[model samples]
Target: MQETVRVALDAMGGDNAPGELVKGAVDAVNAKENIQVILVGKEDAIKAELSKHTYPKDRIEIRSASEVITTEEAPVTAIRRKKDSSIVVAQTMVKKGEADAFVSAGSTGAILVGGQLVVGRIRGVERPPLATLIPTTKGVSLLVDSGANVDARASHMVQFAKMGSIYMEHVIGIKKPRVAIVNVGVEEEKGSALVKETFPLLKECSDIHFTGSIEAREIPHGGADVIVAEGFSGNVILKLYEGLGSALIGEIKKGMMSTFRSKMGALLVKPALKETLKTFDATEYGGAPMLGLNGLVVKTHGNASAKEVKNTIFQCVTFKEQKINEKIKACFIKKEENE
Candidate 1:
């Protein structure tokens, strides 16, 4: 039998807290036999929501957390003050090994701050970066440091490339994933000071399949399997990618409904169109995993629906079953020995 992957879910963290979050936990437990969900939040609210669903009683449990951290609060301050907050409690579970992973659709700052301060980072990991899979024409690309370290150094980025390559090759099953730095142009010298400094390091790095620089325009075309960038640049690329995708989809839907002739055409193409569009849906990929953490900590969109939440939980299971952390540890250990 497969080992159970226990996930500590922050039930009071997102916009649809206790409702969609609870439903997601129920859906996850019902869908997989090797999964168990420990809902962390206000007991009364969580229980009320869980009561609406039918699930394996043994697969779901609730851990009461009296507080909820908000986006406006300073992450460090909130984490320190809100000792009983859902985010803090869930992360603690991971730190204590009570849960295999922690999942939250809460404040990004709180999650990032608490992940480091609470769950801690793997040794030899200079900095833990948020890594997420973004949809691409070739399938999906891993974007490292998506929003964690806004101000980073060349060494941090080089490590990002290595970790990103490892995740893509293992979890995503992409062999020898191509690694590239986000740049202003394809030329090696065309980039900011940081990129110029980091470029040569990645090129000389033997661990990853370095493919030189990749421009932002080439991203959607699946230019590289692993796109490495500092937190600031990666976050900008991700937000713009999400916004543009939404706008284009909206325009297409509007155009389809504008006229009777187009509406009839839509009926003929709806199935195929939907399948193609599903490939680009960010929710289908799940939450961003904060790579290099001692224990897994995933941060999903604050507005995530039940479907996205369920998918994120599944993503955590894959991360565990693949022994991603162990592989990452081995890579770092080898690097340390060489040094």
Candidate 2:
């Protein structure tokens, strides 16, 4: 029998909080028998949203949290003071083993700070990086330190490569995944100080299939399976990727509706176009997981809707079943043993 993956979900964390979050929890429990969701937020609001949908009563529970963290609040101060906030309560559940994972679409800073402070890091794990799956021509690639550790060192990036490889192989089922450091040019010599320093170390890693440096242009072409970078550059790439994708999609839609002839063509091509476009949809891939944490902590977009919420909850199930944390721990343990 499959063990149930218990998820602590922050019901009041996103723009569509309580309603979309509650609906997502209901959808997940209804769809998967081996999943349980503990909704954490204001009791009245959560209950009101719950009334709008029907789900397995035993599979869904509520843990009342009176406070909510906003984006403007200082992450550290908010986490320290708002002990009863939804993000805090949910992450605490993970820390205590009350839940297998914590999922939130709240303040990104709070999630990062809380994951490190409340949930804590795995043994031997330095700074845990946020690993997000970005769509590529072939399928998807894992971008490590996408929004975490801006001041990451070469050693930290090496660990990111290892962890990213583990996740892609075990959870995403990519065997012997290719690893590459992000650089301005394909040459190992071209990049910022961080990249130049990290390149040689990654190439020498025996555990991972280290490919040479990858240019940003090659990212969409699936040049590498695992792209490693410090948070500053990785975040820039992610934002640009998202912005460009949206702009192109908008232009495509506008062109398709420009004239009567285009409208006729659009009707015939809409199905195929949608199927192609779905591959690039960021929400379809779920939220970014903060790898190397003692327990799983996922941070979705602040505007995440019910679909993204549901997908993220399911992503947690895969992470649990694949024993991702255990594998990551083993990798670090082996490294420690070697050193």
Which pairs clash (backbone N, Cα, C closer than 3 Å) in model 1? none
User: Could you give candidate 1's per-residue lDDT for residues 270-298 as a string of tens digits?
Assistant: 99999999999888888999999889999
lDDT by residue (1-339, candidate 2, tens digit) is 999999999999989898899998999999999999999999999999999898889999999999999999999999999999999999999999999999999999999999999999999899899999999989999999897998889899999999999999988899999998888898766888888888888888999999989989999999999999899999999999999999999998999899999999999999998999999888899999999998999999888989899999999999999999999999999989999
Check candidate 2 and list the clashing pairs: none
Whole-model lDDT per candidate: 0.94, 0.93
For model 1, what is the error of residue 121's alpha carbon versus the real structure, in angstroms, after optimal superposition? Answer: 0.9
Please identify model 2 stretches exceeding 4 Å from their true place: none
TM-score on alpha carbons, each prediction: 0.97, 0.98
**Candidate 2 local distance difference test against the native:** 0.93
